[model samples]
Target: MNAPTASHHLLPQVQARDVPKALLDALQARFGAQFSAAMAVREQHGRDESAFDIPPPAAVVFAQNTQDVSDAVKLAAQYLVPVIPFGVGSSLEGHLLAVQGGISLDVSRMDAVLSINAEDLTVTVQPGVTRKALNEAVKSSGLFFPIDPGADATIGGMSATRASGTNAVRYGTMRENVLALEVVTASGEVIRTGTRAKKSSAGYDLTRLLVGSEGTLGVMTEITVKLYPLPEAVMAATCSFPTLADAVNTTIQIIQMGVPIARCELLDENTIRMVNAHSKLSLPESSMLLFEFHGSPDGVKEQVAVVQEIAGEHGAAAFAWAETPEERTRLWTARHNAYFAGVQSRPGCKAITTDACVPISHLADALLDSVTEAQEAGLPYFMVGHVGDGNFHMGYLIDPTKPEERELAETLNHQLVERALKLGGTCTGEHGVGLHKQGFLVEETGNGAVEMMRTIKRALDPHNILNPGKIFSL
Candidate 1:
C-alpha cells in the first residue's frame, strides 16, 4: 500500500478500518448495482487532481438522487464511518482523497437540469450537472452561467468549492450566483436553503455556509444558480507586454478605471510559452493578457478603447482581437487549458497549484514578490490569474519522484501564501480549504474564527462522519 498523503503536510496516522460486514451487506442488498466494493471503483473515487497520494475508500456508492445521498449518509452515520462526497474529482486541494477508510458517495450520476426560469434568470440543476452541460441546455434560452472554473467542473463541485474564474470580475463566483440549494445533512435529513426570489433574511444563511463547506458539513443535492443573458456582441483579445510588471500594471489600471470587461486573464511569459507549445499557436513568448468584452457593439468598443489606452501606457505590443465566434472560442479554450499545458510542459511532473487573492491595491506587489521568490528558489512554475478580481493561480511543476523537488515546491507555496496574507489577502481565493490550507486558515482567520468553524462542524455533524479530517480536524 502507498503512504496516504494528507494535505496538512504532516502525514496523518489514519489506519484503514475494518469495514463492518453488516453495513456492506445492507448497502449491497438495498442499493443493488448502485453499490460496489471493487478496488478499481474505490481507487477512482479516492483520488482527485491534487498531488496527494491517499488510500482508496472501502466502497463506492453511486447516488442517483437526493434520496440516495440521504440513505447513504444514514448508513454511514449508523456505522460511524466517514462519508466523502465525490464529484468529477477535479479538486486541487485534496477534497476527494479518502485519507481515512470510508465510503465514497459519487453524485456524478445525479445530473439533471431540474428547471430553468428564463424570466427570472435562474436555473435549478442537480449536483452532477457540469458547467458546459448547463450552458448547452440553456443556450437556446439566450442565458448562460458565467462561473467557469477552467475545467468542465460539475455544478455541485463548483458550489461546494465556491469556484470562480475569469468572468468573476464582471459577473460573480458561485458564492454570488448560487441562490438556493437542497442539501442532505450529516444525519440524512434533507434541508433547503435560500429562495428563488433572492434577497432573504430568513433565519441563518445556511446556503452560503454550505456553498464552500467542502462537503464537510452536508452534501448538496440540488443547486439553484443565477444565470446571465448572453451578450449580443462578444469580443476576445490578447496583448503582449515587454515585462511582467508592464502586464500587471496594465491590468491594475484597467480595473482601477472601472472597465466593464467580462474576462481578464494574466499569463506570464513562461505560461505563454507553455500554452503556445501545447495549443499550437504562435502567440508571442512574452508576458500577455487575454481579455473578453461582453456587451453591445458600442459598449464593447468603448471598453476596448479604454483598455487599449491603458496597455499602451504600459508598453503593450501586438494587440490582437478575435472577431469570429470560432476564433474567440479557440483563444479562450487555450486559456482554459493552461493547467494542462503547464503540466504537459514537463512530462511525469505534478502541479502544486497556489490560489491567492488580495485587494486590488496589493495584487501587483503580492504577485510580483511571489513570482520573484519562486524564480529565486529555482523552481519551474507557470502563472495565470483572474487579475480583474485579484485572484490568481500558480502551478508549480514538480517531479513527484524527487522528494527534494516536492519540498522546494512546498517552500515556494508557503512563502507565496505568507506574502498574500501579509498583504491582507487569503490563503485560498476560490479553492476551498480541503486539506492543503488547513494550517494557513488558522494564520489567516486567527484561532477564534477557526474554533468557531470547528464548533459549527461539530454541531452539524455530531458524529464527525462527514468527510472527517478535511478543512480542519477536531
Candidate 2:
C-alpha cells in the first residue's frame, strides 16, 4: 500500500477522557461558570480561509481581557497543552489551525478601542477590534488606520499575519504601522515591546518579530498602530489594457516613475469575468488596473496626468476616474470584493491562492509567466495583484472531491513557488508559511536560516505549548 494510504489506516480511537484532567480542572477553576463543555465546538474554530482540512482545538475560550488570555496560557503551559490564538478566522493561510488539539483562545470578546491619541497619530486597541471598526471609530477624528486586508479581520489576526493590501503602496504595511504591542509569552508573563514614538533606535525589534510570527511565539493582547491623517483629496480610477502584459508593464512604469499612488492593483480578464458575475458590475472583460491617488487637488491632478500618459503609451483603454468620496468608496468596495467574487465564480469550488513577491523590475515578467504557466497546465485560475508592491495572488478554483484535481492544483502551486524563488522572490509576501508553505520556506530560506528560526521558536516557546505545529515542525 502507498504510504499515504497506510497512514490513513484507522488509527486507535482516542477518547476525550485521555486529555489531561489537571488542565481541565485548572480551566474550570479559573473560568468558573464562564467556561463550558460546549466550548469544545472544534468544528467552528479549526480551519481558516485556506483550503486545508485540519483538526480543531480541543476547547475554545472566549477571552474578554488580557488577564483572561494570560490565565488561559498559564494553564495550558502548566499541562503542556497547545494554545492557539484565534481572531476573525479570516486568514488565507492555515494560521489558525489547532493541529495540537488543545485550547483555542478566541479574543473577539476583547474588542475595544482603548485610546486614540490624535496628537501622536496613533491608536491603542484591544486585539479584537476589526479594521473596519477602527476606521469608523476614528473617522470623526479625521484619522484612519490604512492597512486594509479587504476582510474586516481583527487587529490581532492582521498583526499576527503582517497583512498588507492595496493601500500598502502609499501608507505602508503592518510592519510600518504597528508601533508597539502588549503580548503574553508562552509562560503567561505579560510584556510590552516598543514605544509610541514615531521612530525608535531602541532595543531589539521584538515588535516586528511578533508582527509576522503567526501566533506561534505569543498571544497579542493589545496593539498600538500608527494612524494617517485623512487625505485632503482622493481620486480613484480604472484603466483597461489590450493585453495582460500591457497592464503589468504599465504598472511597472507607474511605480518606476514614482507617482505618489495610494493603491495600484491589477486584475486579469479572468478575474474581471468573475467580478462581473459576483458583483453585478458590467466591466469590460479586459485586464484592468485599479488605482487610487491621495494628495492635494493639484497633486492628485499631476499624479493622474502622469499615470494616464504612461498607461496610454501601453495601450490602456477607457481610463475612467472617480473624484467624489462616494464614488471612490464604491470603486474600492468593488476592488475589495474581488476575492469573494473570484470564489463565487465557481460554485462548490475552493480557492487555493498563491502569494509571491518579487523585485519591482521583474514583477511584470514574473506575473505574465505565472499566468501563462497556469494556462498551459489547463488549470482554471485568476490573477489579482498589488502591482505597485510587486505582490500578486493567483487563485485556483479546485473541487475538493476530486483527488486528481487536488494533486494537479498542488503541482501548479509548487511550480508557482519554484518560479517565484527562481526570480529572487518569496513564496509568500503577506501570508506567512502556515503549514502550506513550510517546504517552500525550507527551499527559499535554506536549512541554516530555518534552524535559526527554530532556535528562536524554542527560546520563546520552550514548552512548545504555543501554537504547536506552526511555522516549523519539531
Candidate 3:
C-alpha cells in the first residue's frame, strides 16, 4: 500500500475484501427495498470528502432506526464483513472509505430529535440529526447546541470524530457536550452508555471511550448532548491584521487573558480571497481573525473592548462588526464555506489537509511554521484555524494526476504533525485518525498506547469488521 491517507494518495496494494453472494442475498431478502446493490448508491456511501478513491462498498443498507441498524450489523457479522457507518459524509479525513470491501450502513434517515429538556439544558437526538437541525429544534426553547464543524454534520458523525469547530473555544467539543449514546455493537447487540445526568462515577466511562472512537468500536444510534441557554447577547467581529503573525498573536493574547470568547477563527489572505470570491462578500483581503462573543449585553461590550484593545496593540487595521442577525449569519456562512472555496480555487485538485493542534502558548509558532512550509512547497493552498485552542488546518491543493505533488503535500503534513507532537499536542484535534494519521498516532502516543487501542478494537470487534483498516490496522 502506498501509504493510504487520502484516497488518491494511496496506490492500493490490497484488493477489496470478498463479499459472499449468500450474505448479499440475505441482506436483500431481510431489508427488501432498504437494501441497495446499485453501483451509484454503493459509490455514494463508499467515499467521503477525502481525496481517496477506494472501491465502493459491495452494497449499502439504508438504516431507518435502531432495529434496522442492528439487523444490518448482525447480517454482516455472520460473514465477518466490514461494516462502515456513514452519516453526512462531510468528514475531511478518509473516515468513510471502505478500504476493505463490505457494506455501508447509512443512518441519515434515523434523524429525530428525541427530546428537548430545556429546563435541564439537554437534548436527545438520533444519530442522523444534523447540527443545524438540532439548533433549529431547540431554538424556541432559548437553548442551543454549540458544536458546529462547519458542515451540517450529523450528531452521530460528530460524536464519532469528537468534532469541534468555531464555538469550541467556549462551549467545548463533542466529548464535552455528548452525555449518552445508544450503540450497536459488532455482534449486533444494542447497548446504552452514560445517562442524562450531568455527572456519574458509574464505572468504565464507556461514554468517553466511544465518543472519539472513530467508528472502530461501535455505531451510535442515539445521542444525548448538553445544551446551553442562548446568550442574552451575541456579537461577531472581524479584525484584519497587517500579517498572519499579528492575527495569530492577537488570538494567543486573547486566550491567555481568559476571555470567555465564543468563537475565535483565523483565515489567511489567500483563504480570504477565496471566500470573498466564492461567497460574494467584500471582506478585506488580508490575514484576519474572526471573533464572536456571547454573554449579557454589557458583558459582550466588555469583551469587545478588551479584544479591540488587544488587536490595536497588534497592528489591527480596523474592527468591523456584524451587528444584525442576518449579517452575522451571512458572515458565518461564508466562513464555513471556506473549504469549498479553497477546493474550487484549484479545479480538479484534491486538498490534502493537515490537522495538527498544539498548546495555546505555542499556537503562533506552530501555525507560522506550517504556513511557511506550505508556501515553500509551491502548492495552491489556503489556511484556516480554530486558533483560540491552538488547532489549525492547512489545505494543500494538489493535482491528483501529479503524484509528485501529492507526495510533497504528504511530506509537509508529516513534518507538521511531527512538530506539533514535539509541542505536546495531538496529531489530530477534531478530525479523528481515519486511514490517514495512523502513523502519526504511533509517533504521538507511542507504540504501547497504540497497542492498547488495538487491544480494545480486537475486544470489541474480534473479526476485524467494523470500519476495517481505519484509525489503525489491527
Candidate 4:
C-alpha cells in the first residue's frame, strides 16, 4: 500500500545574476519613494507559500498604476534585469521568487476597478484588484464575477496562473472569464489583447497565451473580465459520508448527472478534524462533501433532490444544510482556510501542497489510490478537493528540520503526479507550474512541447528579463 517511490522533484539551481548599481540608480531616480532597496521589502517579496528557499529580489517597486508598471518594467528592461510581477504574495507555487537576481514589481497598490460595464456584463480593472474586492464592487450590479481562487487573489495573479476555485464546476476558471488584457511586453511596450466582445477569431488569440503564462510572459497592467448574473436562489449543504470513496463517488455522480452544482468540495476525515480545530466549528468529522446549489428556487430544489439521491446511494448521511447566508459564509470561509488549518494542525510545520486533476470518470481512480498511498506512508497529511471538477489537493505536513520527511513528502507528490498523468490528467490544476512543478510539466507535456514553450518565452521576452528560471529553463 506504500506510495511508489520516485526521485525528488528538485527545484532548479538558480544562479543569481548581479544587479548593476546603475540599474538601481536609474530605478530609484525614476520611481523615488515608489522604489525600495530595503532588505525587509526584498525579503517579503522573495518567497511565497512554496517551500523553496531562494534569495529575495534585490529591490521592490510598488506600482500604483498602469503607467507605473510600464515605466518600472521599461527601466528594468534597460538594465536587462529580471522583473517578477507580484500580487498579494498568495501564490502557493514559488512564482514570486527571485531565483535570478531581479526586482519584485509590486502591483498591489494598483488596486482599482476602472469601470463596471453592467449592461455589457463586463468590468475593466487594474491588475492589482483582488477577487473579493471585485465581487464586492459588482455585487450591487446584480451581475457577479464567478471565478474565485479562495485566497482573495488579485485578478492579475489569477490570470497569470489561470486560477480557478470551488465554483469552477459551473462558471469556469479565469481562462474563461478574462476577456481582455493590457500587458507590458518585455521591451516595455504596452499592448492590448482581446476585446469586450465574447468571441473573436480575428487573430492569434494572444489573450489565452498570456492568461496562464505565470508572469514569465509579460506584466499585466489592466484586465477586463466577463460577469455573470447572480443566481436567484443559493443553497449550501454538507454531506458526510461513511468513506472517502463514497464522498468522491457522490461528487462524480453529481457532475456526470449534469447537476450544475456551483461548488462540490471534498474533505477527508483528517482534513475535517484539522479544519474544525482551526476554524472552531463543529463539522461532522468524517469524509465529507460540501455542496452549493445555485439557480431558481424550484431549480435549486430539483438539483438538491437529485444530489441527495446520489449521496444516499453512496452511503452519505443526512445533509447538513447551511440555509442562511451567514451560515453558508462560515462554512465556505472555513473551507477556504483549510490550508492554514493543515499547517497549524502541527505547530511550526510546513505542508508541501500538490494537486492532481483528471477526467471526471477517472477522478476516483486518481484520488482513491493516491489516498491509499498516503495512508500507507504514515506521513501526517490532509486531503481536500474541488471534486465536481476532478481536482484534489493533498498537503503533506512536514517538519523543516527533518530533511527525510521533506524528501518523503516530495516523493509522495511525485507519485501522485505520475498517477494523475497516467490517468489522463494534469500535474497541477490551478496552482500553475511554478518552481516546484517544472519537472512534472516537462514529463506531462514532453520535451518537444516544453521546447515549444521555451521558444515562445524567448520570442516574447528576448532578454529573459521577466520571471526567468520559471516554467522551464532555456
Global fold similarity of model 3 (TM-score): 0.97
1-474 in candidate 2: lDDT tens per residue? 111221111122332222487787778788876554464466788878888777667777889999999999988888888888989888887878776678888899889999999989999999999999999999899999999878899999999988998888888889989999999999999999998998889879999999999999999999999998999988889999999999999988889988989999999998899888887788799999999889898999999999999999999997888878888877788888888887887789888877899988999778988898788878688788999999998888888898777666677777777777888999898887886787778879999999999999999999888887777776
Give candidate 2's whole-model lDDT.
0.85
Q: How accurate locally, in lDDT, is each candidate? A: 0.90, 0.85, 0.91, 0.91
Q: Which pairs, if any, clash in model 2?
A: none
**How close to the true structure is residue 137 of candidate 4, measured as C-alpha lDDT?**
98
Each model's TM-score? Answer: 0.97, 0.95, 0.97, 0.98
Off by over 4 Å in 1: 1-8
lDDT digits (tens) for residues 147-259 of candidate 4: 86789899999999999999999999989989999999998899999999989999799999999999998999999999999999999999999999888888888888888
Model 1, span 69-134: residue lDDT tens: 999999988998889999899999999888777899999999999999999999999999999999
Q: Candidate 4 versus the native: TM-score?
A: 0.98
Give me candidate 1's TM-score against the actual structure: 0.97
lDDT of 4: 0.91
Instruction: Supply every candidate's count of residue pairs whose N, Cα or C atoms clash at under 3 angstroms.
Output: 0, 0, 3, 0
lDDT of 3 by residue, 103-202 (tens): 9999999999999999889999999999999999999999999998899999999999999999999989999999999999999999999999999998
By lDDT, the better pick of 2 and 3 is 3
